[model samples]
Target chain A: MVAALRERVRLACSWCENAIGFIQESRLPNGARRVGAGTMAFRMFIIGLVLVGSLAAAPAAWAYSESDPSANPDIDPSDCESCHTGTPEIAGTEEARQGPHANYSATSRSCYACHQVHQAYADGYLLMPGATTTETCELCHDGTGGKGVYGALEARGLAVASQHRTEVTTQIPGGDEATGGMATAALSGYQGTLSCGDCHSPHGGGTVEPFTTDRSRIETDVAGFFSNQLLRRAPTGATYEIGVYGSDWCAACHSGRASGVHDLINHPVDTSATVGPTAFTYESVQVVDGVDSPQTVQGSLGRSNFGYVMPWPRTAGQGTHAPVCQQCHEDGRSVGDVASGRIKASEVFTVTSADGGTAGDNPRFQNFPHESYVENLLIESYDDLCSNCHHPNQLP
Target chain B: MTPDAAVTPVNSRMRIRRSMQILSAVLLVVLLVLLVLLFRELLTGAPEYPVSQEGIRPLHVILGPGVGNRPFFDGPMGVTFGADGRIYVADSGNHRVVVFDSEGEYLFQFGGLGVGKPAAGIEPSWKPGLFNYPTDICSDDVGNIYVADFRNDQIQVFDADGDFLRVFPDRNEPLGRGASGQDGAGIAVTSLTVHGERVYATDTYQVAVFSTEGELLDQFGRPGAEPGDLDHPNGIAVGAPSVVVVSNSNRNQVLAFAPGGRFMWSFGKPLGNDLAGLSGELELPRGLTIMDDGTVLVADALADSIVRLTLAGEFDGRFGTRGAAPGQFNAPMDVDEADNRLAIAEKGNDRVQVIVIED
Candidate 1:
């Protein structure tokens, strides 16, 4: 298309030259008398004027940088700087929240990344430069766009591959809000697609709390960071409160997996895992190189100190209950790939302490539906995830 | 030269010369036109074109400015423009009324249960200055705010400055439920709007238009799915088409009535089939505002948008989407327009989205 435009411009210029040459081919009434040089030059000038006017009518002929947005200057910061702060203060002094959508971008923070600033066209929600939430995100998230590793479009598109059906165009934000299920739980045909905004807040820029300990804190503490996808409603350790927060955020639609009502998955979630009696916790055996030693222990239902935090759900109170979805179901196809200058980038990530000190590392699971995990596999088998709480016996 | 070649007639030669000149002029004009046409299309069209031609666009959003971060909103139920032109919102979940300037900037708020802090949990309050789930809000002639203090079951009045003025009916239950829905049986004032001399209200199933002095000026409409019959009528507004009420029945429609308590017209039956409502289609229509131009804007919760219609119930346009973005809404419950600025109250998002309506 660009080449065609350039060629068309050349053709218009040639046509203009032809018109000027036409006046030059004039003849006087007497066979041999030629028109005066001055008169002939003036006529050529008139042809030139017509040619310039034609070009003006179609600006694309000469305005080469029209399609490139970069040809324009950056949006002046003073336009929005009077209100939004570049650096926002978070709850903790060191855990600076950095306002919203401020940090994490290596590129210039030219407010132009998402906002059109002046002649914005999207129909609200700060939707500029694009139409839907998906389009706005795709501005930089598509593979060719921002290389957004966890692109919103891919999530909705990969729904048929055992990924959760986010293609449904229905608004079940906190799930069904009643009997839990997809938007099509009752009505069929069209439903609202579970777009990126459904789970993550685009403007969600705040301190990242690794895991939930208190049931109340779950209401706050939305998106973690940029490289790490933003999760607006990270679950709590307590019972899933409908549409509120915690485990219920997921149970809102997956009520079939919730406690009490979930008859299919008989091993109810949010149920006590320490019901039977054990002699000072379950005594187990271990062996030394040369001597046989029986290691005895107190029964701790949901304690994880086995060299790892054990990819599992947050525990309420002292951690004694059936596993929440987060316990086994995690995000990201695999652990984050190792980055340069730091430690291995698998599940573990770099961390900074409240005093601005460097903490060794923190683990995170990201952009899931990893490999065959969504449909055919699990992070770890049920035996490994459950043995931490329930010690079962073989049925006779 | 003419004397040398006399084979052609002089008259014929003159005519031929004129024809050739005209042809050359026509060809030159045609060439110029083609050049301009090609030039326009050869280039990429205008980089930034309008995405929508809707008269209104989102300007700002007011997320519940909580008190010390205790999380203030469970549902910001209703919104309206006070005579002072300030934005008044019914923060029902916290049993309070929060006020903001025309720009939606939080100014001051009054009336609430308990300490009025949502994080501390709610406490029942029937005092004149306090309330219990103040749902619908509106203002009278002199910028005096009237809130339907749900559990308190009274029309609590206040001045523009958020100061307590007085309580209607003075008694605990003088604010009748109206007829059956108004008999003070098992209901509170469901909806409220201000007209010429009276404040029109709804109570589960009935309509109450009262004088600013708390006198019940008139009562009309009933519970049903037919014309003028309001089943589960939760919203009310008076416009050129008379009294318009939104019914939350299985039929899911809006009914209008003449000022004399007679049926006029109705729209939205069994609810519009689509969430994005085409033309007059609607999802869950809630609070409505009558634009000065005689158009109606109704809040459709499930669709997460505002559906606009003509006074005659014809679809005009729609705005908004389902999200927490500036213009997006999460279950918008009510909307009010004043001086081209629209203040939208959202139940799910717990905030009021403000947009400037373009003429």
Candidate 2:
């Protein structure tokens, strides 16, 4: 029965492909592509002009959601997506199957369309007409599925508490208020609704990551896992482990210089030699180890969104060097290679999950999934984790 | 050849090539249009550049002269012109009050640095012979200049000729002697503006209306980030009905209060690199003054320029660049309007410049 259910799911996925192909073949009544490349491009160009030009004028335009009801509903998510579904057989239904945003739209009906291509995020873009930063996520996943799980966790007080909408009501200096200039908080807070577009990119890939980009413009030699096979382009061809690079996506909102939200990251104003090296050392896109640099998890990638501070290894004795993430996440210890910073390929990573079992502590435990270590992986990226080895006396 | 190779044609390559040529042509056209628009905006916006006008450089007269450490801000600082056209300065830096003519000549200097004496507390610096940093000196309709002795936490009454009339003791809560977010700070009067029988005095943090005899009729403003909160409030100006403007220096914005202390609105952003080039134009707006036509002039100290804005906080245009030239200012601190003449105190340059502001 389970096999039959899985097969049915796979068949459902194929329905999207059939619809896109059918749309591609069928012409409009006049026999022209309903919205051909030229016309669509022209429309896109005009929209781009309106987006960029209107944004350049000032962010005070009050016409965002006021002009359109189908795209910008005052209440209820279902009503918002009603007019947003373009080609009933294609856009709203089929394209979602092969797309990551599909899961988001499947469960939610009310708020699944009328997406703000941009102008939806405080960090990435400006606010659209009629919608504040808090309304971005209501476009879809109005408390359903993965987003529902996350929201439920937050609502039930499992995750960090969000006073986002309420805290902004009171005016205070450096607090969140959105009124007369007298309210200081209005200028210091973030727009708090994480949307699907905030994390995923369904259009083109390559230079742009899921929701982030390599701002440093660093060049690398190692091929990114997802790009090599599909995009036929290697964005950063540098040998580095996964998970570490994903942290940059989180920093987009957390950084202190964010115009939308209160700067969550402690941005460096003046330099202190005690903190660590600044990002100014390298002029290229590739991350290079400086004379005195932070210990990168994958030898030379990046980790943690701490703007001013970088993590380093907690050294023991005199001249010992710590192993990389791959070496730390492998099997048992083997004394094979001595040179090239390569170990015997046996030293492994230690992961203590929420259930209290070390993932790879025992060589017999081979089928441990990587998700068990996600929380620990985030914690290790901080400087606080290094204190265990830097000051051994404090560690139990 | 293999069937697999034959099954996939090179059609995608040909299609991509055609698309590229179309994309390039479209991009070029778009770029050209953008360039033309930008060029037109640049050329038509300000056709004539700001030029220098001929004449003797206007002199900035520091009206009521007081002495502080080396520059000012000591016993006396505030200076204002009376309706009779006489200049009255707090001279709080020296604990004395001095009066000068419009031509920068001293007419009479009184009030010593110490506490006021019974018969002769009429010179610079009173008992202990030193007044604290008096922030403002303004004359009412009858030529009676009210001096805001900031540090002394009182308003001293003096005749236009520098005669010591009486002292208005600090009725504000005895907070303390220091300034830290406005708390624990004594009642340091910063500015005074009198309208008819009502006198509005903005202490360090509170805006109070007095009835000539120093009786506080009502006071508003607390130290917080709320709408009506005032942080380090200074420089009071009374305009149209119920329009009272106070400079909240700490917030880097001016708060407008209604006649009865009803919070009206606030304008201006804190000075920092964040607001730099907000409009592709640099500004660090401070010291606001309203013209007869409600044209607000802001002396942006850091931006080192004077910006003109509408009453609704719209940046109209800007004048004066960063310099010590004839029309330029080093640090234009305060502005006062009288008839068609505007008096600007250039703090860093230590001069008062008079400008014939054209509409």
Candidate topping lDDT: 1
- Model 2: runs farther than 4 Å from truth? A1-396, B1-77, B115-130, B171-186, B270-287
lDDT of 1 by residue, A145-198 (tens): 121224221221222223443335444422432444434332121234555555
Candidate 2 local lDDT, A1-396, one digit each (tens): 122234434543453355345546545777787765655545445544543454334222211222234554444433334544453222422221211223224343212122333222222223221133333332112121011112222221122212123213433222222321222222212443223222232221222222111111011111221221111011122122112222222222222221223324332221112112321211111221332233332222222121111323332211232222221222221211222221122422222111111223322111111121223222233333343233333335
Off by over 4 Å in 1: A1-396, B1-55, B66-72, B114-124, B169-187, B241-250, B271-280
lDDT score for residue B65 of model 1:
51
Write candidate 2's Cα lDDT for B337-359 as tens digits.
66656666544334455665443
Local accuracy of candidate 1 as per-residue lDDT tens digits, B259-325:
8678766677542112221222555566787888888888876456788878887777778644444
Supply DockQ values for each candidate.
Answer: 0.01, 0.01
